[model samples]
Target: MERAFVVLGAIFGVAGTAAAAAASHITGAGSGLDTAANFLLFHAPALIGIALLVKTGTVHANIGRFGGLLVLVGVALFSGQLALRALADASLFPMAAPAGGTTLMIGWLLVGLAALVGPRRV
Candidate 1:
């Protein structure tokens, strides 16, 4: 699980960087690519940190794993749709971005809950 998160984090980080560069060079003002890049960049490190925390026994593994999965799904939906719209004028679905945003929020909330409710040491 920890290894999976780490791999995902690295992938996200690289993809985010590439998206950011593309946004700067290929996208104009008001392009959703920038938003996608921002979301990807922001969450990459968080996912990596969650993996480390889980491996170190600082967080509940199951909860952290679920949260990480949420983050991954959120990123794929939100960023994926935005990139598609920006680059190709397409939509993943009717409300994919909104759904992704909601999922991202839920994922973050779960992470916070994990921190608050996870087992603690003396």
Candidate 2:
């Protein structure tokens, strides 16, 4: 689980940087890839931190795992849909991006809650 989070973070970070570059150079303004890249970039470090916190007992394992799952799914859906639309002119679904965004918000809240309520080492 920890490895998964780190790998996901790396993947997202790489893809986000590439997408940002493409958006700037190839797509220009209004391509919408900028938003997707921003989400990926922002969440990359967060996902990694979640893994570390959980591993270190700063967050409950179960809650952290679940939150991380949601975060992964949320990123995939949100960024996937937007990138698909912008680059391939396709849609994952009608409301997939919005749903993903909401999921991300909920997952983040859960992660915070886990930290506050969990039993942590002194």
Candidate 3:
């Protein structure tokens, strides 16, 4: 689990850095790719790392587990949906992005809940 978190953190760090660089290369206001990629490539990894911390039994607590899962799902939807929309220029459901945003908010709330629950002792 610790290894997994490490891998996820590394992946996010690289992707986020690359995306930030790519965003700078764009001349205009924005393509939205950078914004979308930032969330996916950066936050996704951070959240995954948090989940890894929880899963490794370091933060063993039901709230933490639930929060981790929520954040993971939220990141997946938030980032994945945006990437799909931008890269494919497809939007079957107009409400997709909004839904993703909502999921992200909920994920943050879950994390808060976990913090309230506090960490379990090893």
Candidate 4:
């Protein structure tokens, strides 16, 4: 699980940097790319933290894992759709970004809930 999170974090980190560069250099690139990059950059660390917290038993493991899953799915849906649209001028069905955004918000809330649920080191 820890390894999975670490790998995901690394992937997101690299992809975010590339997205940012694309947004800056690519002609006719829209804000969707920028938004996707920001989301990926922001959630990458949070996913890593969740992995650490779960591994250390500092939080409810199940909750943390679920939250981490949500983060991954949210990033894929939200950022994925945006990047697709920005680069290919197409979308991955309707309302994908909004759904992803909502999922991300819920995922973050779950992480907070895990922190509140106990066994925390701090």
Candidate 5:
């Protein structure tokens, strides 16, 4: 699970950076692509941190893993929708963006919960 988080984080970082570069080249800065890129960039480190914390006992392992999964899935859905919309002018689905955004928030909330609760004592 730690490795999964790290790998997903790395993927998100690379994809976000690439998308950001592409977004900058687009005429309108407010394009969905730009927003998606920013989200990916912002969440990437968080996912990585979750992995680190889980490994180090800073965060509850089970909770952090589940939360990290949500983050990863959310980014994939949200960014996937935006990128498709901006580039191809198509929707991944009717409400993929909103759903993804919601998922992302829920994941963050769980991460926060993990932090608040603290790790289980050895």
Candidate 6:
């Protein structure tokens, strides 16, 4: 599990770094790369945590597991929405971004609560 998290973390870290670099080349100062990078960085550790969950066959708590899932979904939607807006020049649903952001916060909170609840013991 630990090793899995490490790999996941590395993947997210690389992606975040790449996005940040691309942001520099985006020309427009407000290109959403920074937003994407920051969120990816934020979720890097969560990826590790997810790996840990996989290894242990469990999580600190069910809530944490659910939270991690939510976080992943939230990041995807939030970042994807911005990218869509940038590439398509249309928002489709501008509100989706904020909704995703809200899910991220809730997911983080659930993870924290899971930590407080402690991991399951076999």
Candidate closest to the true structure, highest TM-score: 2
Clashing pairs in 1: none
Error of 5 at 31 (Å): 1.6
Give the per-residue lDDT of model 6 (tens digit) for 1-122.
35744675777788777777776776244778678778888888877866576456564756666777677768867876776675466674769889889987888787777777777777
What would the TM-scores of all predictions be? 0.91, 0.93, 0.66, 0.91, 0.93, 0.73
Give the RMSD in angstroms, all C-alphas superposed, for model 4.
2.5
Number of the top-ranking candidate, with lDDT as the measure = 2
lDDT of all predictions? 0.84, 0.89, 0.61, 0.86, 0.88, 0.72
lDDT of 1 by residue, 10-79 (tens): 8888888988899989996469898898888888888899888778877766777788788888888999
RMSD of 3: 3.5
Error of 2 at 120 (Å): 7.0
**How many residue pairs clash in model 2?**
0
Instruction: Write model 4 residue lDDT over 5-120, tens digit each, in one string.
Output: 87998899999999989988882356689889988898888788889998988888888888888888889799999999898989998999999989988888887888789564
What global local distance difference test value does model 1 have? 0.84
Q: Which stretches of candidate 2 lie over 4 Å from their true place?
A: 120-122
* Candidate with the larger lDDT of 2 and 4: 2
Whole-model alpha-carbon lDDT for candidate 3: 0.61
Clashing pairs in 2: none
2 or 3, which is superior by TM-score?
A: 2
Q: Would you list the rank order by lDDT, best first?
A: 2, 5, 4, 1, 6, 3
**Candidate 6, residue 44: CA error in Å?**
1.7
Residue pairs with backbone atoms closer than 3 Å in model 3 (clashes): none
Candidate 2 global TM-score: 0.93
lDDT of 5 by residue, 70-93 (tens): 888888899999999888899988
Q: What residue pairs are clashing in model 5?
A: none
Clashing pairs counted in every model = 0, 0, 0, 0, 0, 1
State in Å the error of residue 100, model 4: 0.4
